[model samples]
Target chain A: MASKPPVTPAFSLAIDAMGGDAAPEVVLDGLELAAERHPEGRFLLLGDEARVGAALARRKRAARICSVRHAPDTIPGDMKPTAALRIRGSSMRLAIDAVAAGEAAGVVSAGNTGALMALAKIVLKTLPELDRPALAAIGPSARGDVVMLDLGANVQCDARNLVEFAVMGDAFARAVLGLTTPSIGLLNVGSEELKGDDRVRAAAETLRDSHLGANFRGFIEGHDITAGTVDVVVTDGFTGNVALKTGEGALKLMRDLLRQVFTSSVPARLGYLLARPALDRLREWMDPRRYNGAILIGLRGVVVKSHGGTDALGFAHAVDVAMDMVTHGFNESIRDGMAKLATQSRALPV
Target chain B: MASKPPVTPAFSLAIDAMGGDAAPEVVLDGLELAAERHPEGRFLLLGDEARVGAALARRKRAARICSVRHAPDTIPGDMKPTAALRIRGSSMRLAIDAVAAGEAAGVVSAGNTGALMALAKIVLKTLPELDRPALAAIGPSARGDVVMLDLGANVQCDARNLVEFAVMGDAFARAVLGLTTPSIGLLNVGSEELKGDDRVRAAAETLRDSHLGANFRGFIEGHDITAGTVDVVVTDGFTGNVALKTGEGALKLMRDLLRQVFTSSVPARLGYLLARPALDRLREWMDPRRYNGAILIGLRGVVVKSHGGTDALGFAHAVDVAMDMVTHGFNESIRDGMAKLATQSRALPV
Candidate 1:
């Protein structure tokens, strides 16, 4: 009865149905739209069953498209993700667990980041000796798209963690960006070896000694984020968070400034109308929705993260990102690749 | 036949002859412009006899214009400021020493920051028992300018240091922004009381209990910097430097992006041409030249710190800022008013 799925294996996504600032409606809208596009893709919707079911029933999506799984509680954004992992009933934990247990191919959430990270770590666990999992965002760059990581996974990290991050980041880039070997850069205060704090200097030394160091392209500064000079930008959570927020704030400020300038006078407003098409094209390129979702890397299974304030369109893009990772065998590839490194090099610190 | 300086007892400003990337060219240009505007103002040029003398010889200004002092050595930018301070022949140190000895009303430098701070601190010393001086910049806000301190003075600061910064920032806003009792805000990871690290949270409590507590505006986040939500944003040197750099990088990125969009197509270029006047006005308003220099506060003598990369226009504006502070007696006013607080405050940890 239903048309064949866009792809064969029928990607299964575990959605945190109650997550995000405008959940349920937007989540349902995103799900219905994606279901319509893929027809055969299976989905496991995790949240309060009654409400999720009610929302889905109104959508008129295919009956076999999605199944409901109850997760009675939700993770509050303020709680530290590490602490929230211990609480059993959290929706984020249940969603990630579904993917880890093979009940679903991927997990998607727009919940409290700390809680999602904690849950993913506990349920899926780190790959081999990876001490910490990192959060990565795939955003628009001057070179089309680039990955930035450790956005806020762990606040403080040593050189070993950075070395591992470079490895994981490279693996993710291979899976997502499709680069054979992604060029990785360690983010610091400046490009010079003498720049940044103690952690950065030590990280640079460790990176220079590793086999992974071949693909590691020197240090990059805060301004280098959107510059598109490298495939991946690596930094500890604190600096990364500050940089991320600063970028977000800048985009918004520029948009406001542009709008004010466009509408300042009658002639300018007429010019805006005449140039609306080109401006809109430019806006689409810079829109957050086009690149909102990020993947929580260094986990046992695929887990995509949508921003807390994402709308239906953004959520739909996150679903597509998860589907892509599943089809690409992202997790298995990382595990197999890292395993070879572990056997060949005992020099890499745990 | 030099005319007598207008009858301002506590106010005068000495210009550095060998400061900034462009050196005497930009500095002298600024001096000439300011001299024309304030015909009764006085300036002392500090540098080598040949250069300063030659530059002065070229200027045919009002009689109250200039004086010159010779120095045997110059401090290059790459060397550490402290090391440069140890050299007695360095022009920057000599100019700062003039201010300390009350031979000049103020000293302004666009030279190496670390060097100027070191020389100023050593020669002028802190007000009484105050251990370290803070560099303060006036961040432009919608309501007015926010007094932000320790732009890069102290890197590692404690809870007590932040509290003192808030107090000093409040006093600064009162004197500069012309608020009788200005609002103070602590820069934090979030607006909540429990949001920041141990130091920030503890400092918030201390701020609440201090005499400056009545007008304290609580915690403000990074986005608040451009949002103009607070009259004062106080933080230690590390975070402040990060914020300042982020803003600078973001501003540059936006300008570049606008240029790219405008030149992408003929239609867009035409639109940009039509909107040029309004956009140009906005650019002028946001220009760094208009907000040229920072005052190194809490020292016994007034010192203005200019940006290292400043051009002729920026240099000119720095001169204007220096003139304003000198004429307004900024140092003596704050020192005499906060003498009690300065004496009672605990000395900085060495």
Candidate 2:
């Protein structure tokens, strides 16, 4: 509700082309697809120019709206965040720097998550009222799409940090999911108010008493994540990270089991052939590529991290998330919401 | 490895009949099924005589082995542990007391989990070396089955607590799953040693140096839960609870989506008919009844908690878990393992 209209004109996004498993190839392919989807959008591609140029030349749509900016190095997948901070010319750093320098409205990368988070936090910095940024990602639920935050950024979070996450997650859902007023729930072991640890209980108290209380749905269990019990699910990094990965693992297990079942007997294989179209639709609906982007919320500029192992389609989905944030003036809304929360907290009794 | 042959022969198990959603009927049905499977076993059925007698009248096998103990009250599912503790004659308390008095080798209850854990801890007490008890449960995995601990027992755990969990989990895997030596892993966000909090890192260090180090597999991610990367998963109650429920949520989502897909078209329905046998096998393999019990580990007596919402088959599975623990001398193995760990820890440098 606090969101304001976009003050700035349409802006270009920067891409870290030399990141992810497929590097320049997948990045270029994703860019081409994104370009066709958003014809008015422009991209500043950061990587080795020779390789990026060659990849771009093959894609007419991407070549029309994308410009290459060469970078000499890339942040390795296993590099420590502290070690990654010193690498100035790395593609991840350069793409982030583009946002800082006003050349790009946001940055998208299928790269080393820790390194990317470290670089983005340093380059773009947190919003004025927020202490730290959170990683928010969309997950497919039975009812619809659900947004969850603090995915692995701050492993140990306090009450205040959780409150901040709830605020950010609410804004994220509205911006990315196109919701007018997203309902929010704090992820807990049980739905009862007295279920979790001190930090979670305190956070729930604050949310219940805050300006966003109307949209707050109190405590929700882990099953609520996929059940779509609420539009936004807020949690500490440790629990969020584990819950997200656990869901992914379960999905993979079921998929593998389904494949084994279908291939086990001749009749089953024949049935698979007849059901291929419907099954394909189901697979597409549940595809990880559709929800590849993990957004770093509560930051001054938009930053979307794609899964490092994702293909072109997944990478393009990450780009789409960044585009949504930029187009919706997501940062401005977060800043306004944070300012209101600060004032409201100060006015309340200790 | 420290497990010994059962010294106590042919002991009866106490069942809390006045619990769960289906109450006396499901409990009676489950007892009948369990009685048929283990005809040598006897049961001390705890509930109101009128209700228990009426339910048992229709059953032949269970009526032969079960003797009813009149329990005037039942712990309501919504009652807190502290409140439930005051009600002495409740069915849950009486069942646990049966184990403490040595009338029963173990207790199985589809009742209030918090109350069961509380009463079991207060009545039966923890093993000498264990500070607190943990809730361990079997979950279906890709390879076979996996054991995860502290499902909802200890909300916060220290390094020593986690190490104790690893020890208890190892013993649990051995006794319940019939494994000689089960591989153990600490559940974390990443498999790397440096990825977790200080407590987790400290636990890993301790497990690696302890006598149980032979079975220690270092750190494992949340995905490993369903992947069956380790025989036992060690985690604090908070993360464990969230991960377990999230996995369940994902599975339910996939099942619902599949059902929707198959029912959308006439050809899909026909394909479903052709694939019915294979799909039935898959469903059977993933059935919740097969993995119904959550065991309270590190206690002096074996205590199994069935899902309150589960039907007769699920309750029977819970009884089976209790039988396995009782027959294998689970408490004795845990005691022996803990004694070894205590000796090993003292010899090392602080």
Candidate 3:
């Protein structure tokens, strides 16, 4: 088992209160829930003072643990990542800045994903020896939760970039999912070694010969993602993004089809009521809110991006991920893993 | 509506009778079903004479319409495409050769995808002005069926390749799905034109300015596949293959979860009985057999590859697709579309 990091009470997380669809209200509600879940956790809430102050008025318990800072502007959902970088007074930027300034251990936002990635990359920068940061998220699988990475952080990636993603994904599964030594697999069209593009083949070869080869499962197909064939699924951003969305689309289609089936007749409606408890359990198990957070890994500090359309519960889950990262010292583990990889790559007879 | 090709009785489809998991038996059963569906359709069955003759004896109806040929060899599923290319007496190769020799309009096989592609490419070759063939399949969607390609035909595709895929996918959707001016969307990480890699962006630009621009729907995310946001989704083989398999995985996962939900308690069990009819309908709607065939588009002749593990019903659906392609003159439509694209591309300012 990987050694657990020391529990630290000094870690605080920054929240972009005016980020998601519901904005300050959803953020405050989520903060209250998170605060209740983790009594020792502290929060720095950045947003319009009046709006945040009004929302906080109802959550005295959460307000006691959160310190609010006034930010005059907001980053629009449609704003490009480059344009978002110039908005200094925006709540999203200010919240991320808190982490960069060491006022907080991590940052959580439900803002535009591209903007969040850009601002976090600029503010916290990447870890030493890492060329780019990857967005990692946990997805529900048949056996358990699966960690997948590079979910649109870098559109096009090379062999070395994929290797880096594998390392970061491995550390992430260990840190957040509490896996001891997670099996990692490079996502490809087929499990066969000769089935994919040149970049994938080279990355697979590197992983096979690396020190982490014992835990590396080689190439895994798309079905393997939900089959829980591997603990960590690493791929380039474009493919990862598409796979993630495609899975989401399939689940949505299933839900819609089920709804249609149950509402088709009176007997089906009765069955729905009778099976309500079991169906509810199934729904909760597959709830998007339960798997809400997507972390920008390889960053100097932890940054979590929640789905912009998600509600309070989803935002709270994002906070849980951020807290887990900060408490577990995710970045430290990644640094150690990278150092080991660097040595292993150099030790190879060139 | 797109003009339907004149239905000609001269169209006969060739079957690789020694392919699939339950070869000869499943092939005969599927042929029986297809013969009943298309009373006027003729079939050329190619396989080992003894085995195929034995299966054909029990399938009198299919045997009446099929003319059996003695192909002594069978291509093993694990054989490489290149190795399979040299086996001239193999059932798979013979079935494809029948199309080249003008004995059949198209060929259908539930065999090794790689070998089928390679053999078909060698025998039937590619259509004029088309560099490579692509695998195109129809997937169930919220609005109906959506045509997507290339499902592992080319691992790495350039901007020109993507544009070609868009053209082929557009034609396939129109021919098989019976859509007039089917809207086309290039699969990407984001819906924005500037969001994806150079190839995707370049393809989008070409599609936007070409003769097919009016029917082009711009970039679509993975979720858009099942959402039925567009009629045709064009992508590189690697991405398309991953997306297709990911979707299949998600559907299987949903089915497993539903089974657990419906059998958890006595009430749920009773609910299952009450909802059986509706659930059955839902199952029929999403049945794999209903959308079995995946056509290798851009080839000189139509070639359909069924899932190797699928049963007789699935194989029948594959034959159904081949029959549709032949009767609808799918290749002719593709040739016309490519000619139009070539003319438009030449007229553009370099």
Candidate 4:
């Protein structure tokens, strides 16, 4: 059973200041940046008061509307979600608690993804219209930035789940990416209509006939992701996770190979110095920091997970994503989209 | 019904001369390279006799060991596999025909992948011990070269199919990659035993207790593919295909970005000139031609597919791969492994 979540005035956000690899500093610095953009927003900072309070006081803007909550414990990055869930004193859990308790509209964390997801689900519960919450993130493509969903949420999803993902992703793009109408594509082995399994085929059929049919671009292959064949790429958790990791791995490999090439000889080392500026520009364009936020959509409260290893800028980008989801009524949009989808499913044997 | 392919003297290979984007030129030039390596090798060239014969006559070494089959019709690269199967006069079909007629031990083609797979399956059939034939390829990783299988072969694989893939991948690693005892990992969303679909979990269970259990590394996540945590990464075709394409796409994206940076300014251009030699070495190490061969594993006959977009050097690598498989008695090894797997399954309730 799935239903849309109630619309909430998500003006305040809870922060897990002890989350990320950089921890309290990244959170404090990120909040300062976020505060500059959302002057009216309030933040409930969860972590050690002594640590975050000293840092928060230094950031004028972040300190103005932020309140530091005493959370003595910090969840280890490698800690299992089940173990983390039992530790209520952890900053991650405390931050999520703020959202559940209506102190904040959403919670942002740069901690263990598994623990975050598990804790968020148990506390916030899923939206009325979702069987499970999905993780959605933005990635660069040849054309532009593209939105991909179900990064590692549900390992197994039926056709219905895919259709639901398309709805959530469309709303997400509209909100964060600011696309008026984003083209949707179902990731598969081939772009041909006859290709893929029954679940993928069925999902394609539903999307094609649904209200979002105008933006549905049918099947797309792996290369199509970077090719930017569509604005939103949707697939089950397993394939999506593998694809994401594989893409990351390839990029790292090339980066390493490039590094090796640049340091191989004295001539090459000099060449690297000359090429530093242009390469820096290229690096900025492809920076993982710019796309650090991964939203857990379809949850009762907004949840954005930042990369655990990211610095202040990356954590700030994640904050921006969460704020956008809250301010733009991202959940409400999903509700409306899902309502239409439900009507369509009822009208046809989808 | 799965049975081992009959062992034959595989000293000769059939060549689809007019297959690649460069057609007879890449084929003939590639044969010249293969001939240099295998002096006793025989090649039956299938293409327009005048074109292939004229080119063959120019290459002294290739001319000595090659026989032109006069296959005038060249299959279009974009032609459907079903359509290709009906075209008996086509060069791609003729090459397979020579292998079927026992004139050649195996067939190599840089033709339409779908057409080749379809035609090969229809003519040669699956091995006695397998439910389906899989496509396997080698790719670079952090540690070294790694083998991944079922790359768009079976979209929906069961537990049995996954287990079978492990056996085939193990044999492939030993035969083509020349690994003594390759560590195999089942591609999953997470490495935890509790994660993934039932089929994946079941496959992991069987592999954990099989004869290859010592080398079986349980489950591996997507990043592990590039991290080289295992020697062979095995998964269903759909996921494998997507992961491979994603990795390729990422690499291409980085390459394009690097090119843009290199040409951005006068200084960058000068730097590129200085770095050209070292960059060239890096390019050679990561060349597509070096890893051009994608074998159609579990087939009754040795069939290797080359990238249609590749050049002569790449095509030669495919020939080299086919020759290696033949020399190593790959299919026989798979049979022996499967036989042990069968006995183990019989002994236990796998």
Candidate 5:
């Protein structure tokens, strides 16, 4: 194994080079791309040193900013998170260790989400105000980019957890999305005051009375997500995960149906040729690659999880997400928000 | 008020004419369309006598097989279900009363959902096995029409309730969707066995061992709903409602985005004209009107609730749904399935 990582640049991020479906090469390519955009973003590439170093040698830009670190093993996607904890030499574990050792500002991986979360919690711990960290991601909405959280992190959540997610999502929107005072909405079955269980209602009441109440939109239904009724849509992980996947499925269905229609006849094919440019515009606007990262919020350090199926550009976006959080001191913002709310009154509803 | 209803035909349905946004007119129009489809179908319209009678006079097809019943009151869309229950003479209540009194084989309404369910429970009653009725609806999937249940009917479902919903959904798919032995799945965050709550796991276990085991597909994710991974998707009403609405919202967004693309440029508009036929075909295939009814299963009679914003065609489809269930003895089938399950050890997990 190579020697341990040396002192790192301020915004350096640890890359789990052997994590994704197309590992090492895609990770290096993504880092090169990220290096172009974020000149100040340095990387500690953690993987099988021989393969990762060879790949890093080919990508001049990435090599210039990245230091190769030897990780003896790779975490398999199907392995249980608890079991993976014992595999300390794995690329994912090494990246997380870098963050814990203060060699990296944050860590990014497209590895097993469960393993990443479990490892990050143990190594980095959580922000003091958080009971559990939330899985937050940015997706396209009619108005603009909207942030959603708890996308399958904590299966069951109480009022305090929900309120915490709202706070984190709110802070994320302002930090990454550059919103002045981003509004937030709690996802419910219906917007009616009487709808949803006691947990949601209680969370709403707490948010409503707090200082964030000025930007709090009461309750939004699932449809409000794409309708862009609010900036940050917060919910328990169970529903949030289902809702996110459901949205993806619907979009996929539409895309398939549209493709079938376009190829149905010669005239339709011709129509597609003519409409290609505008359709391409639509495709670009809704590209999933542009929103590749799903971050674990309420963590002491930025922790971004890229989708396993993503390509170089998508992985680059995940790196961008981590760097954005690191540079903006996002955890500080969340802490500040919680501290202010606590001073005003107890953050939890009585 | 008029006299009591006369003896009705075998497949007679009571119409809540004052229930929908379009009122007695759209209800009568839908009946006229439904009459053309089912010459054997008869209706007893409940609303203000003069208004309903006047509307009936204009629709020759509907009038020939229908009779008017006077119900002077109307239930508001936002009225609480409990409050609506006290208004006995409201058209929704009258239609439910007609079902309870054996004046009609089923009932169709586009009224307040909460009120309809509450009133129907009081009047028509739930079948013996059900703790609460589940809402079932058909929607377009890649393979074909897929039946999903518990769509905002019973928010919190126990293991027993989920098992009941699976049985009811099985009966519904066979009788209404016309599948010989429809496959079923329990919706969860992930398809893994350990993905969902205890209730879903228990229900899966029960289904796996029961007679329905052959057709059960274990756990499925939310994306499976539109992917047509199974013929029936079973979930608690809260998640189902959110998933259903999320799908709707995604489709709406795609529709809007397509429209914008089509109108964005001259070449695009010309391309749209050329592609109009195929696009229309796609629209027809995925038409919401084609899947119009959400039925309250586990009830004594077939009770269909139409979307309030639907047109005459959509309303007619809702009637068609009700009549299909009535003719197929869907409720009887549900009872049979439950009875069979009861005979094979207790349905709930030990």
Candidate 6:
């Protein structure tokens, strides 16, 4: 007799259907494409059931796939993260509750970043001892994507925050990149131990004293973000936000400049003709979607934030990312690791 | 009879011969080109007599066109601004002192920024009623170059620092861009009045209450830096430096990405070929050298900071910028206007 095939447990994503500037349209499109790619991946769209159903019906996808869980209100995009949490009917809250109730393996949103973080903290909660949650984004580097964290998730931070981010960022690197002991760094204005503000100086001292799973590679600078300087670069949210947006604005400006340069004169245009092969190799490497989704780590279950300006293709990419986190058991691994570390010391913030 | 052409006072520029990474060579090159550009322009190269003489002979220029003023010690680039000020023999001191003594109309440097500011403060001093000096740079924008400050001159700032930057930056915009009244906007994380930290909020209130020459346009964001959303964007030096560099780095990356995109496929390369004309216009507009010089505003005399990594061409542009400021009496106009304001309010920082 043939051996019985083992059953693979099904995992579902609680997608905040009302979130995102494009709303149900982009979300529905992303969901359908993701379902096509991962036949086993399922979604529970959380929003007004009637509206979500109607939107899905228009795409003719309602009958084939997807289910709706009604959420009455939503956190406004402009509302403060702290204020948004008090609103109980907010869709972010409902989505987090779904994960906590075991209805979904993870949650995803491109909505109010602060609200998602707050709701994640309230419902999903951090590991029993974890003090804060960090938003980690994977960036396109020379080697591949590098996971960078606290990309504007926290306003103020201490030495402990840096150490925690390092720990969390390491788990992210390992799960996403399959690197056992990824090299980690504390992002600073300079690579020297004596560089940057006092907070960073304190963090550097703390990182040196701790024994993180990843290798601590001193400090990293602005250019290092793109040069593939480390597997993980940790910083407080303020600087991270500045770095991320700076990169975005720069990429946009450069794209415009190149088009102008290539088409400006006949000889330069001809020179571009000769340089065409090299340029193509670079585009595939810098595609924004390839680095779109950012995981809100330290939550009880997986949660991802897609860029607000992403197109259908980008949204699809983020969905595939959400599915990968669930399948790889990234959260469980992080929890177990932290639990182990917690036993070793009681000084951790969590 | 010929009305004697108003006896054009001998135009003098005190070159900080020991300022940049490449120092005397680039300074001499800049002075030579500047002298060539304006037959009336005379250079007072401040450095050791031997080095200046060697550099001048190498250029094969007539020594009569330039004069040398001896100063022994050089300010090391990495020294603290305050400490550098206390050291008496520093070349920066002697060079700035020349400007104060009416031997030179302006001073230019590519060396120790902090030392330059400190010595410039001690020698040239701030305009009457002015508190701290600001390093102002012209950012490339869609409308034209926008005057921004403090471009990394001071890190910690209060509302008064921002107000002074606005006042100085407005004067610059008028002097260079020929605007009767430039629009001034505080660079905040957002446009809303209450969007920024305590300092920003207080500054917004102060700006709304104060009277500056430029038309105050409220707030602008990082994206606005490139979009030319406002004529003058005021922030503390720290954020300004990060924003400016971020924009620069992003432009380079995008240029790289565009080259890759156009060359990757045959059709895209053809598109690039078709789009060649537009690209060149963009590159010429965004060239760093075109906007290379930064004015150290609020000083009693004109002081321009040329890019540390400047080449011969860039150095020439800095010289041109200094020439315009001197010809237009840029510093005096600001000193006069600010002095007028000083009589009315004794509480203002500057």
lDDT of candidate 2 vs native?
0.88
Give lDDT tens digits, candidate 1, residues B9-123.
3326666779888877677777777778778777777888788888777877722487888988888988776589678877787888777666677788898877888888788
Interface RMSD of 2: 0.7
Tens digits of lDDT, candidate 4, A189-248:
999999999999989998999999999999999988988889999999889999998888
Q: Model 6, range B229-263, lDDT digits (tens) per residue? A: 78888987756765666566566555666666766
lDDT of 2 by residue, A217-284 (tens): 99998899999999999999988999999999999999999999899899898888888889999999
Give the alpha-carbon lDDT of every model: 0.73, 0.88, 0.88, 0.88, 0.88, 0.73
> Candidate 1: lDDT of B227?
67
Cα lDDT tens digits for candidate 1, A1-350: 00122233333888898888877778888888778766767988888889888888888773359888898888777778667877687677788777766677778988886677667877887766477788888866666677877776765567777767777787788777788878889876557786566666777776666666787778876666677778988877655655666566656666777788888998788667666777787788878897878788877677888888888888888887787777676766666655655665445543
The total of clashing pairs for model 5 equals 0
Q: Please identify model 2 stretches exceeding 4 Å from their true place.
A: A1-11, A345-350, B1-10, B345-350
lDDT of 4 by residue, B1-350 (tens): 12424545443789999988998888888888989998878888999999999999999989988999898688899998888888989999988887777667789999999999999998888878888889999998879999999998899888888888888999899988899999999999888899999989888888888998999999898888888999999999999999999999888888888898999999999999999999999998898888898999998778999999888788889998888887787878898988898888533223
Q: In order, what DockQ does each candidate have?
A: 0.32, 0.80, 0.82, 0.82, 0.79, 0.23
Compared with the true structure, what per-residue lDDT tens digits does model 6 show for residues A183-229? 88877645756556676676666565556633888887666666677
By summed lDDT, the worst window of 10 consecutive residues in model 4 chain A runs over A1-10
Chain B global fold similarity (TM-score) for predicted model 2 against the true chain B: 0.94
Worst 10 residues of 4 chain B by lDDT: B1-10
* Model 6 score (lDDT): 0.73
Which 10-residue span in candidate 1 chain B carries the lowest summed lDDT? B1-10
Stretches of candidate 6 above 4 Å error? A1-11, A50-65, A72-92, A112-118, A121-131, A260-284, A329-350, B1-11, B21-23, B57-65, B72-93, B100-102, B112-131, B256-281, B327-350
Candidate 1 deviant stretches above 4 angstroms: A1-11, A32-41, A48-65, A70-93, A112-128, A141-146, A156-165, A215-219, A324-350, B1-11, B36-40, B57-63, B79-87, B121-131, B141-144, B323-350
On residues B52-148, what C-alpha lDDT tens digit does candidate 3 reach at each position? 9888988878978988899989999999999999999999999988887777888999988889998888788887667788998999999999999
Which residue pairs of candidate 5 clash?
A: none
